[model samples]
Target: MFAADAASRALGIRLLASGPGSATAAVVVTETMLNGQGSTHGGHVFLLADTAFAVACNAAFSPTVAAAASITFLAPTGLGDELVAEAVERVRQGRSGICDVTVRCGDRVVAEFRGNSREVHPRAQRPE
Candidate 1:
């Protein structure tokens, strides 16, 4: 997944670290990510946080996918800003999981995200 995350790669996002139930990702805002308002796009910010949440949830679980997610933007960032997203697993039970991700620029939080994941059986992907 990391080798071929085309969307994240296109946005210059890098997975800095990941482990069971935790992950961190980073991205440097560029001109292409700016919106017409001249600030970073909210979608890009959500993507970064969502990526981190995905990694953390899938770290120990096999082929987990997000069932739902929501984000609240706290601040806006400009081009050249360095953003970091960190995800932590809040709960995982019986194929259901919850994760929280925080997006920040330095010490200031830029956004908060929560993701709900449901684990899929590998067998489900096989054609009958």
Candidate 2:
């Protein structure tokens, strides 16, 4: 799934790790990812987290998509900060799942993201 993520790939999001129910990704803050205030845009931060969430949710082998997602910005970051997002499945029941992601630059927490997922194709059973 990461290999086919065109939007995230176009924005320079790279997979750091992926497993059954977890994933990590990194993105370097570039000039293009900044806002008018010289800080990295919130959208970009959420994108980083979302990318990791996508990888984690799909790691089950069954295709899934975000049913809902929300992000909270904890700190500001600027160009050259390599933001890393780590996602882990929080809970899974029936056809729904929850995942939490933490975005960090060095040791500072930059943002937090939570994604709710639903399987898009049920025929593909999620691998345990």
Candidate 3:
């Protein structure tokens, strides 16, 4: 799934590792990712966290999509800063799951994200 994610790839997000219910990814903040205040855009940070959450949710499942997600920007990052996002599954029951992602720049926390996921059944993939 990571290999096929063009949006993540386009943003230079690298999948560092993944397991049954966890994933780690990283990206370098670039000039294009900056906001007018000379800091990395919040969307970029969310994207990185979301990518890790996506990988973790799909790691041991057939397929899943985020039912809902929210993020809190704890700190700002700037150009050339390397950010890493680690996502861990908090709970999973039936077709619903919850995951949390922590985005960091080295030892400093940059953001926190929580994602609610729902498995996409094969039947749902069929064209109506």
Candidate 4:
């Protein structure tokens, strides 16, 4: 999707999955994205996971909206480190869904996130 691409380019993200529900996406860590200690910023990880969640939820149902999200940082990542974010749909309730996403570098788990999204009715589908 163009939104995904634009978000990626503007935020310096990379697509690892070809489609929405795929599993993972590669994220390149740059110095600009790192903190003072040379580790990736928490916001970067959150954005990566959030983007993946958006794609996953939207692919299943269009116009999906994020209801809630929680992220946990387990480890640190640095510049030049290629991170992989994997998102899995955990549950679906009518027009809403929950997803679990994990970010890793090789065998190290860097972060994890849980997100919820809701599908909004299209203009044509709205009740008149």
Candidate topping TM-score: 3
What is the C-alpha lDDT profile of model 1 across 1-128, one tens digit per residue? 56667888887899999999999999999998999999999999999998999889888878899999999999999999999999999999999999999999999999999999999888755566
In candidate 1, stretches whose alpha carbon ends up further than 4 angstroms from where it belongs are 124-128
For model 4, residues 27-128, the per-residue Cα lDDT tens digits are 789878998888999998898888778777776567777899999999998989988888888888788888999899899999999998888887685566
Q: State how far residue 13 of model 4 sits from its true place (Å).
A: 1.6
Model 3, residue 99: what's the lDDT? Answer: 99
Model 2 quality (TM-score): 0.93
lDDT digits (tens) for residues 8-114 of candidate 2: 99999999999988999999999999999999999999999999999999997578899999999999999999999999999988879999999999999989999
What 10-residue stretch in candidate 1 is worst by lDDT?
Answer: 119-128
lDDT of each: 0.93, 0.94, 0.97, 0.80
Better of 3 and 4 by lDDT: 3
TM for every model, in the order presented, reads 0.94, 0.93, 0.95, 0.86
Off by over 4 Å in 2: 122-128
Q: How far off is model 2, as Cα RMSD?
A: 4.4
What's each prediction's clash count? Answer: 0, 0, 0, 0
lDDT by residue for model 3 over 1-128, one digit each (tens)? 99999999999999999999899999999999999999999999999999999999999997899999999999999999999999999999999999999999999998999999999876655566
Name the lDDT value of residue 55 in candidate 4. 75
Which candidate has the top score in lDDT?
3
In TM-score terms, candidate 1 sits at 0.94
